[model samples]
Target: MKSIRKYMNLPGSLFLVTLIFAMSMTPVSASAAALRADIVQCDPNPAEIGQYVNVWIKIENIGNTRAEDVSVELIPSYPFSLDTGDDTVRNIGILSTDRHASLEYNLHVDENARPGTRSIKVRYQDDEGTAWNEETLNIWVGSGSDTFDSKGTIQLEQITIEPEVLMPGDTGTVTFTLKNTATQYSISLGGEEYDTNARIRSATLEGTDDITVKSDPYHDTGILGPGDNVELTYNIEVDDTARDGTKHLEFIVVGSSYTYNYKWDVPVKVDSAGIKVIPTKPLTIDNGVATIQFDIVNTNPNTLTSVSIRPQAEGIEFSPVEYFIGSMEPDELFTAEFDAQVVSDNISNQQELALIAQYRNGINQHETFLNDLSLTIVTEKPNSGTGLASISILLIIFVISSLVMYRHKKHQQ
Candidate 1:
């Protein structure tokens, strides 16, 4: 997980940072929800006490008065507790005014608490004795519980890797988790433990102090009894040694093929982790047609296959909304040509050439919007390929005839 940047606010300076970008280093400049305090939003309005939940909030002028302290506390004996901004539950504060803040936290409900009607509150109050605003969440819990933490078969259930996308050589960690999938209690990592799409850059067990990880996909896997959990955490080094673009890991659990594939995109960038869209200015023409050539450079460091492009109306006419840029290697340059017809009568216009890049990420694949596309106008008359071919044929015929006649006259003389 990327470290969520935390800073104590000192009265009224704009305390805006990553909001929607999920731990992004900078704040997006424009937003409607960024300027107000109805900031943080949570999902599963009325949640069950023991269920995992996600809370999403948008903020503006959070610590408007003095980077006032803010904390989302789960009432006593609550199932799960989680919060962004502040790592621990103590006196906490974030930026207040003129800043847009977006934060999300993943928390789970505890299984031991007595069941009944309860409420969870996300409270925001100034550090000093002052007014406060709060959002109350209702949750329902079961009565005297006899439920045990998932004690199912120790099936090597799932592995979630952070930084779903990355450039080659960018390092991240791959965590292997064993869920009590079956009705068993404990599982072990003593058997064939492997990442189908991952190459171990470095790995260390949970308690180890070393950086280099020795991974044995097979020889010593573990055991998972029903409803128990175990994890083997490994450090991943995107093969700085391979081509750029997306590279995925493939794995088989036990013996049956687990249909999940893990991969990452090798971006054109050498230092960044995700891909950036270098949008091109759309095709410009003076009259009715424009031919524009645009290029895409994978910003990731892994090799990418079947990278897709979606065209956002570039103020010009386009046929298919999506175009496929087949098989791009990391840092490889690929071209896409678009010829938009500009009806001479309606010229001045604004449109976008939008693209969404979809390829295989490490595990389950996902899609990222290149969102950046070239915008262009039509000012020139486009040459018709068919018409050009016909003109060339006629000119060729005329020249051939003239040459034949000259040769015949010379022979007769």
Candidate 2:
């Protein structure tokens, strides 16, 4: 009887222990997995100062089971300020998933905000109130470092132009003004260098493009404390092959910061340089010969164009009525001068002369000039040694006559 009672009691105790173990195995708490935050993008990708940015984040539970009542909080630091964009950056309040969904956040940075990499710590708690996981990220803002201290210190000049008109293959030049507001600045132009002594740095044509300009080997490398400026020159070239219409330098810049984008408007004009005459003024016509002045004013923004002048005179001799005026800017006056002596064999009542200039821009370097310049040199009666020579001979004869008469009178007296 004692042995049987022992066996039954042992079995009952085993059952109770098994039941207790199973109850204890039931899940009673939620486990917090690692927090993974991925940056989708900061649209306008590299954000500009005072510009709006859209950032997307991808969060994952990274746990075996789905998460419940998920929440994330973002805190901003210096230079990284957030504009109150309703619910864009605030807590999602609650979310649930084995993988966190991509949530978009809209933020705007102030114009005065500093530029740099910014990161936000992600904090969250599960429905069961477990431990929080966090991480950091390197956010990119601008393509280059934002030297706010250097901002407005270096600036380009304003470009202005008048009479927006031009002919095809025309060449001209535009001027721009820039200044350095900061105390010191170093400028690099076409591999050349320059420095400013004071804080205010100013440069003209600082950001013009496609000018093919080489800076003087001596650069502006002086320290600028404030309010200093330098003039920049761009040698413009209008391609003969350029379209007959308008030409543009789409992206000129003053500084890297967004606030000072005024440099984009630096003055630029294509095909606006006025007509260029091959041979410019001061043409002299010999007896019975006629000639005209030929010239060209740069009608577009191009470098000093080399020109050839061809003078033509029919029915009369033209003493090579041609010359070159290296280059001329828009609104500038130019004239070529040469003596137009007539050839011995020439005969015609009225004669016409032409002067032409030719050069290359891109392809098809063309020629243009003043044509059919009219000079009516009515044939003078056959000269009996006229002009200075005739006058000299007459004077000599008169002197001889006077001396002879005076001598005779003296002899008579």
Candidate 3:
């Protein structure tokens, strides 16, 4: 009876040992079936604001056993959003040992994303629904300047201004070039080959009070494909009262997928008109009458209209002192002449005369007065009168001598 009991107990103990060994091996087998995943690359390396990007991930079965029912997921956070709707999770199915699988996902970067490096969590699992590995990927986000679309598309290429130097009360045009720098390709979806189109919804211009936009701000450019470009134009006018300096103009470009805002400094220069009075000939006084000759010059870019000059001197009388110049174009010169008499004999040889210039800038038709113009008056040489008298007396004496000589010759005959 004891031997039989021992044999039964030994068999039962062996059976219990076998059961424990099998249970211990179960975890090892499960552990052998593991998955590891890493980010391969992300399209649009520097993600743009309010735009979609594609992220590619490479997964491999690094363990001895095969992984079944494999799945990958992205842990969402701020500045980064999932565009896959409820499908943030992807099923990779079966992955054999040392084999790899590539997965792609569509994600969106938020419009208010700060510019810098950001991280996102990626996770993977196997058939047993057990977590395998979690990875944190670093991505770069930009402020529209360095960002591009998934297909390497650039929306705003360049902006150009006509009449590079802008002046007050001047009208000009501005042009913006929209380009797509993407490589061309076609993908079949729903049994149809679909091509990508870059669509511009609107374009607008904002300027300061000194500048006015005459053209409509909004423009619709239908579509642009790979290596294609379009030019948009706007008309602008500068205010007459605008001062000369630097002004800014803001351009906003909106697309079906994104929006870009840019600012440019435009130089504003006001056309200036000036007046200068210069003597055309020597100013001289003869027999109490002073003859004045001068040239009035418009020394600036703007045209001057209704130009007139008035001359005044102390202790001197002027005949028709005010001269009408009519209209003067830019850099124009007008000749003027007048006569004046010294009211006092004590007037010096060099007299100081004040001349006032009155004209309109032609822009606003408002009169502008310049009162600082001056002229110099010089007296003629007193020796001129004495010399003329001497010559007259010599001529009369010669004529009398000739008449007497002729009469004496006739009497002798």
Would you list the C-alpha lDDT of every candidate in the order shown?
Answer: 0.46, 0.51, 0.70
lDDT tens string, model 1, 63-142? 22435444433332356566445453334455544443445656666756556555555554444443445566554444
Q: Is candidate 1 or candidate 3 better by lDDT?
A: 3
What is candidate 2's TM-score against the reference? 0.32
User: Between 2 and 3, whose TM-score is larger?
Assistant: 3
Across 7-76, the per-residue lDDT of candidate 2 in tens digits comes to: 9899899999999887776443355344467664445445666777776676665565556566665655
For candidate 2, the 10 contiguous residues with the lowest summed lDDT are 209-218
lDDT of 3 by residue, 193-294 (tens): 655556554566655567766677564566677788988888877777777766776665555443332333444344444678887766666667767887
Q: Model 3: residues >4 Å from true position, as ranges?
A: 1-152, 185-196, 259-413
Per-candidate total of colliding backbone pairs: 97, 68, 0
lDDT for 139 (candidate 2): 58
Best by TM-score: 3
Residue 227 alpha-carbon offset, candidate 1, angstroms: 22
Scored by lDDT, the top model is 3
